[model samples]
Target: MGAGDDAGKSFVTSGFTGTGGASAQPPSPSPPVAPGKVEGPLKSITPTEISKRHILSKIKRGTPSDVKNTVILPHVDAEADLAAIKNNQGKWLGGNKYEVNGRIWGLEGSGAIYPVRGDGLVEMNKLQYEALKGLITHEGDRDAMAKDKRFSRYKFHTTDEDWNVAQGVYDQR
Candidate 1:
């Protein structure tokens, strides 16, 4: 039957279903949380962040590099204030598009939030279709990145067929 059917002794259907008139005790209260020493409004940009969308020069691999450096309408209303993301995706060893994003993270101990502009790049490799897919992997994890001051000059090399590694430049202000 339902709960607390003590061999049909008492037809109790409420919470106090004691076998021989014994009441159940409620659970104890939880411990109080410790006070936090440091508080943060931590903000990290993800694909959901759609922060700043810009159309950089999509220079196709050709003789004079067909550059589209002008006439780009900034979608900052739905985006942010980044005019461009210094793209370093040039002609790849394979026939694919590599994307690098220069992002600036706030120094943890510092109270600054200005845009220092650091770019990270990832190759689509004719395979993956996301812009920043292999960026951190191509570059390095956050710790490896933090320890190595040369993150600005960091470059990733993979023999992935559709993934074209670039020999261009990144802009991390």
Candidate 2:
């Protein structure tokens, strides 16, 4: 069709030869599936972390409800990044680059955040973890959160067997 072709309900040629329909063709390349493992206990985020968030919340603005986290584990040169972070700080600038979805979102305030390093997923678990931390007012809230729809689908890999038990109904015949 020409550029003038009006938008409509449509499909694609997919560039595959002799297709009876789109159904018979293989889907695009995909990430490999990870092997399954037995579930583990509901690992607590820690009492101290909850307290920290509570204090920070009183002083800071954003609440748990207002945020959704995306963990970005750093996947690059630890030493060089740390040096960059330090150099950036000496000059007063942005932090080291952390790759997420293959893009490096640099830090805004500081030059470097060299706490954790090497083959790790930088910032990946941070925001969500902090949000979870902010939500832990007491023990019971944690229990309710297990059944929380917003968080249930995102079963922490740490919560092995418990996650399976909690998630079992959907898979049943």
The number of clashing residue pairs in each candidate reads 16, 17
lDDT (0 to 1) per candidate:
0.22, 0.27
- Clashes counted in candidate 1 amount to 16
**Which residue runs does candidate 2 get wrong by more than 4 Å?**
1-106, 109-140, 156-173
Best lDDT among the predictions, by candidate number: 2
Predicted model with the maximum TM-score: 2
Q: Tens digits of per-residue lDDT for model 2 on 1-173?
A: 11112243121111212212111123233333223421111011110111112121221223342232222121222333333222221222223344322223334232223222112221213333432432433222546665665555554642333222212211110
Per-residue CA lDDT of candidate 1, range 1-173, in tens?
21122343322122221222111223233233223321222222211222121222222212121111111111111112121111111111121211223233222223222222222212122211111122323352334432443332222432232122221111110
Give the lDDT of residue 18 in candidate 2. 28
The regions of model 1 sitting more than 4 angstroms off are: 1-126, 129-132, 137-159, 165-173
